[model samples]
Target: MGRNEFTVAFAGNPNVGKSTVFNNLTGLNQHTGNWSGKTVSNAFGCMSYKNITYTLVDLPGTYSLLSGSKEEAVARDYLCFQSPDMVVAVVDATCIERNLNLVLQILEITSRVIVCVNLLDEAQKKSISVDLKELSRRLGVPVVGSSARSGRGMSELKEMIYNMTVNERKTYVDKIIYSPEIEEEAEKIFEKIRQKCKSDRIARFLSLRLLENDEEFNKSLEKSIGISVEAGVHKKEYKDMIAEEIIKTAERIFLSAVSFKNSEYNKRDRKIDRILTSKSTGIPIMLLLFGVIFWITIVGANYPSQWLSSLFESVNQFVRDTLTNIGTDNMLVSVICDGILKTTFWVISVMLPPMAIFFPLFTILEDFGYLPRIAFNLDKYFKRSGTHGKQALTMCMGFGCNACGVTGCRIIDSPKERLIAIITNALVPCNGRFPSLITLISIFFSASLVFPFNSILSALLLLSVIVLSVFATLGLSKLLSSTVLKSERSSFTLELPPYRAPQIGRVIVHSVKDRIIFVLWRAVAVAVPAGLIIWLLANIYIGDSSLLNYFTSSIDGFARIFGLDGVILAAFILGFPANEIVMPIMIMAYTSNSSLMEYDSLTQLHALFTTNGWTVVTAICVLIFFLFHFPCSTTCITIYKETKSIKWTMLAFILPTILGLTACFLISNISRLIFMLAG
Candidate 1:
């Protein structure tokens, strides 16, 4: 380490509050990027304490050092190779037993370590107490109790880190001693590694890995050492013995160092899980939660959306008046106000509120630790459909945005399973699609009912559509897995984290900053150009009719085959940039109004649609098509980026369009047949 600087790596299991500690320590001075040649994200931050700069590296959270997954590989490789000055193993105090396994693994690599037991408040709430002094003695390292949420023990943690790194304080290293047989085998491998390697620390860790017969580690070692260490004929037997011994040692340390006062420390979590994960009630509860969120969003968003629309409308009118007064060309003014300004307003006004409400609500569920249980409940279904269990998690991410969901498929280790996840991700309705789905449900399905119940019905109706989407995702996943992406099911370990009280302020900040604003910005970027193009098509004349009418008329006959008119079809095509603008585009095409015109209320919008020949059957077909249509342009681009193949991206685009057309055609024909019989 340099005199003025030190590098400290933070490592821990997922959900151990590792991120909270990193953020608290580093504040805003951080940047994230992928590890070299890996898709796993690694973050680094720097902070100054007492004139010394402490550079903090946040490793990907993993349960163990053994490289069973990408996260474990990145974290294990960094620790073994990068050789940071100090390793801070952040453990969940509430479940120190399970966390200690990782700490034990880290200790095997380096002696300069600190065990930070986080979430102490949650532990205390459960009547679980840890004797920090005892734990420090057992682990032969510094152990600090912290509640990163409350900023507790942060100063002490930093001071201890400073002392250990700057002062070169000698610390006791309490190492795990394997059984005599395993130790002898490790010693032999250790000697071989030491003869070939310059670093004594790395040699010791490599011996244990070699004993385990870890092929990946062996290949990595060969690359670094420029030599191969061939195992003896009995290496497999020795590896099994060594692995069993490590497990026993971890169990022994956990038994000695941790204790619970309640004996039923996890009773509350178990009780909640019983209800949330019950076979009969689980799916219904999940659906009900979805409906409640949609209801809250639908009811809560109305006033804000209307106010934002009015505000934007006022701005547009002001811009128009200013342009006219300045003698600006009417065509230029129309392009700016009617085309660009109005479309941007419609997207923002429609998208912002629902996103603002939904993201925060979703974040709350996440913070409360319910999302993994959702994945857990859905895992079996995914497995039965010939996909990996983790697809449930990626699918849930798709609800926020398909592009993000596609990126998240890296968690699945199998390439085939990951591809299945990426291809089917768009089947779920993203936040961009929510406004369109919700508005149509309100205007067409729930408009006739009275106040309170009307909103409830709208929410239920939207939930049904969402359920349909989920089924589509599962069905397609099954079909694709069985055919194009045929593969055996892969298993995954899911940790059902203990539920914690969500931090409202943090949840709000994260959801708004990370999700709502991020997605809204993307939508706006696409909406502007789409609006300008729509305006040009409407204004630019061709022959006796405008270009917009000529194209709509040409497509109308084919569109009616799917129970949609040419105008609606044209709107969907133009609205490919962002799904939120699809309805507005349809409105613009149908009313022959200025591209920027805002409907004051749903009643007026309903009247306009009816005047254009919309009916119950038409609304039903439109809803079905909207639920299953092709992904927006952003998602298509994301698919291409993630897959790095035009073939898969095009297939992803075509699959959903085929499903949507087929569904609409069947529904339209069935409805027409029933009408003919009745007449």
Candidate 2:
């Protein structure tokens, strides 16, 4: 490393604007890469000032280092092991009392810390103020107050960072004093570990850890010291005393350094929470919000989707004509234009517009802190289903991508509950599946209605599907808890963060970069190959029929039992690579095309479906199956990667597919029975 280069570790409790501060400092120069030998990823960013380069590492948001959660362990290990030149403790000034817990804990490990009081604007809105000088004096570290969203106080924060790392100011960190008995016990082990640790604070921290009987910490201690050290068991009272004292110290410091102008400032938020979290209004309001989001997405995406479709088709024809004019083989022209371009653009046009509309709306809700209320509202259902309420958060993630939802299941502390969440996540339709669901709903369910009403009706139907998916998840979670994954329903505390106004510009930019582009690129990657495969299957003929037809005809009879013909089911099987290509595959097979084809609008798509004998029963069955079917290829692979067992992965695939098949069978047979009776 260069003399001017420094590594700074940024740490904080979740939702404290730590990432915002990092983003302000780093801008687009950031990378989310895993540290050596760690599962949880930490974000890294590089920035420069006055010819000196700083490497900022953003740690996972965790409340306490003592908490043995995998995520907290990563943060703790990095601060203890890596020995970064400086640490920045980002805290929410609006809730300084809660945030000080992590900051004080960091002080115990290292005194070289800058306590950044972020979200000062939010605090000011609430009529709260922090005495930064008093806080700095008490903590014996440099403290910077920053309102990162508006770039307020950011310059001071950067200058403080430069000063702390380069100038190396001396800090006398105030330690959390425990009871006499705990101190005496810690002293016995402190000298034993002190020589190796070389810092009094760290030695005392490790010494206290030895007394606490933390197995994870003990293992880590063994690694650092290169030998196992045994400790006598401490009484429960002593351990409790240490934890109690830490909080008491934080409270004392907060009381001395922070003040509120209006004590009832939060009264307004509490009143709003009453309705948002009320049992009766919560679910209804939640449904309405999602319904409106869907309505907007369905209505707003129309013009842009059509426009992109026309633009891509024009580009396709131009490319095709240019190739033909150059005497390029007709086969080559068809492969490039009709096969690859058609399916790829079909996915892009269909998938991009809805995502562009959906993710930003979702992100706004996320930034406004309403998402936790979603968990609060749905906690009872998940609790009844034998899982923690946090499953709701993961299920919400599934709406964007099931693969992401599966990865997010790590938040569930219980192994059994995490598995259940991962297995059931795909029940909720993701963005890739939304296009097919909306198209089918628009064509069959709401086509006869007028303009805005039709969009609203489609949204209601879509919301109904979402409701059913949630219930299905609950029911499946219950079944798994009762069956192979038997476990008691564990209760967890869901924190309802105070609501704040979202930063709209940051929300738009982050939603586009993080969600829209990532998903669109994935869809395109899978679509091109899917398009080529469709072409080969359609063009390769055996006897009088093409291979695609022969295969569909073979499965046609079996498919009839579920109210869907062969082409639809085959499309699903082929679309395993990505859900976005399913409709395109179906269109190609239905038309008996030698390559992929595009339907200009939902009207044209509806006509095509009708020509292929798609009845209401077919549409309903497809929609149900669409919701229940095996997850897209990405999600299944994520399931396997997480579970690390073929058995669990196979079960994940089978459970949803079985549900889809059973639901389709019941619906198709019941519809037929009613029709026969009426006739």
Candidate 3:
């Protein structure tokens, strides 16, 4: 520890403004890693104020430190064992009563603490107010009021932290007192703990944890103290008594420190929820909102995509001319122009615009706090599928990117449920797949409609595909739960946060920085090498035809069985790296163009596909396959990383591919039979 350095940990419940405060204080100086010997993520950052450096650890959000889940265990263990210089408890001002429970638990572990009452603006909006002085007086710690989103009171927060860490301020610690009977029993256990643990705060904490019979925490405490406290009698009864006492004490403290002009702080949110989460309108409204977003993404991307494509084309031509003028080798120019530049251009031009629009809109919903309601609405369905209700939340994440969805499965407490979420996540189409699906729908289905209705029809078609994908997720989840990854549905508490107006600028910055660019970069990394190999296969000759032609001919029979041609099948195989590149590969294969070509409009693309023997049935089969096929390379790698088992990874890959092939074959043959009978 340097003289000017200190460590502080930020702990709080979920949906509080803990993350916002961390980001505001530390800005971009942060990185994340898993806790030692655990899968839970730990975030750390550094900030310098008043010539003193502060290293902040953002602990995972949990309601309590009772060790019921990995998140709670990680948060509790770090605070108890690591012994940071100070602990900052970030609580929601509007719901301060519920948040104070975690704060009281932290007070039992550390004397050095600060209470940050965040979301002051939200509290004010609801006509609820917190007396900061009264809160600090009752808790015997410094209390700061802040609206982190608006950057209010940040300076005071930093100053208070500095004062406490530099030993310039003497603050008292007020520990909560349990009921008479529970306290007497806790004192008995504390005496035994004090023999091995020297710190008074930690000894009491261990005593309580032992009484609670927290298996995970007990193991940790036993290892630390070099003794087993599991011999305590009536442990379960003691835990229940202590828990009831703590809740009563929390209620008493909340009454003293907070006041409300209106008792119903969530009146507005409740009113909105009636319509958004109603049995009748909930699902339909969700579908309509998503449909509108997809409609905007599909219709809005056209002009910008065209502009970008044209710009890239002009740059490609200039590069080609320059290479010729400089006497560069023709082969090298072809590789640079056709293999690398064209492929990269095709991906960015087509993928970027839709993502740019879609991510911001998605962020708006997240910031508005509608996503939890989505999980709330879908929880019963997930429960019926024999998976945890939290899986519904992870499934929604798949819409942005399946890799993220796989990563988001960490929230589920059960190992079995988490694995099920990871495996079935790919059934939901990611943003990468959306471009291909949208383009195909526009070219094949929407273009046949009248002018204003075409875009609406395209959006409806995309929504149907999405609905089908959700059903696939549910069906596969059920099958996996019964057969391979059998588990009972685990329960979890989902907090429906109060809605707030989204900050447009921050939403854009966060979405673009966190999601759009991150996913795009991953796709680009895989697409580059895949592009080179694809170009070589198309350009290299074998017996008076290109190698691609030879391979497509060999696979034509099997491909036809799925209502697809060899060229389309080969394109999908080569497009495993990135779904966004599938249409480009298909175009390159069909036109026999040496480079990836860009069509000016869907009309031109439709004409090309028709010339290549595409019909409505072929398009329908392609859509079904797209919805059900194997996960992309990025998603597969994420699954392996999360599961750490090759067996599960291979199963994840095979399961979806089998479903896709079976569905496409059945649909194709049944349609052909009907046509034959009609003729």
Candidate 2 clash pair list: none
The candidate 3 region of ten consecutive residues with least summed lDDT is 29-38
lDDT per residue as tens, model 2, 1-679 = 4379999999987777777788889885231111111113477889898789999999887778886766677788888878788899989898888888888888888988999998899999999989999999999998889988788888998898888887777887877878778888899888677788847888888888788877787898788665355753467676677777888888999999999999998998898898888878988888899999999989988888899999988998899999999999998888777778888888888888878888888878777878778887888888888898888888888888898789778767678999999999999999889888988998899999999899999999989999999999999999998899988665586667778888778677777677567666865688888889898898788888999999888999998898888999999888887888889889888876432335878888988898889889999999998999998888999999989988898889999999999999999999999999999
Estimate the lDDT of model 2.
Answer: 0.83
- By the TM-score metric, which is better: model 1 or model 2? 2
Superior candidate under lDDT, 1 versus 2: 2
In model 3, what is the error at residue 311, expressed in angstroms? 1.2
**Per-model C-alpha RMSD:** 4.0, 3.2, 3.6
**Would you give me the overall lDDT of model 3?**
0.81
Please give the clash total of every predicted structure, in order.
0, 0, 0
Candidate 3 regions exceeding 4 Å error are 29-40, 168-170, 179-199, 219-234, 512-516, 541-554, 592-597
**Best-fitting candidate, scored by lDDT:** 2
Error of 3 at 303 (Å): 1.4
- As for TM-score, the candidate ahead, 2 or 3, is 2
Task: Tell me the spans in candidate 2 whose CA falls farther than 4 Å from its real position.
Answer: 29-40, 194-200, 219-229, 513-516, 542-544, 593-598
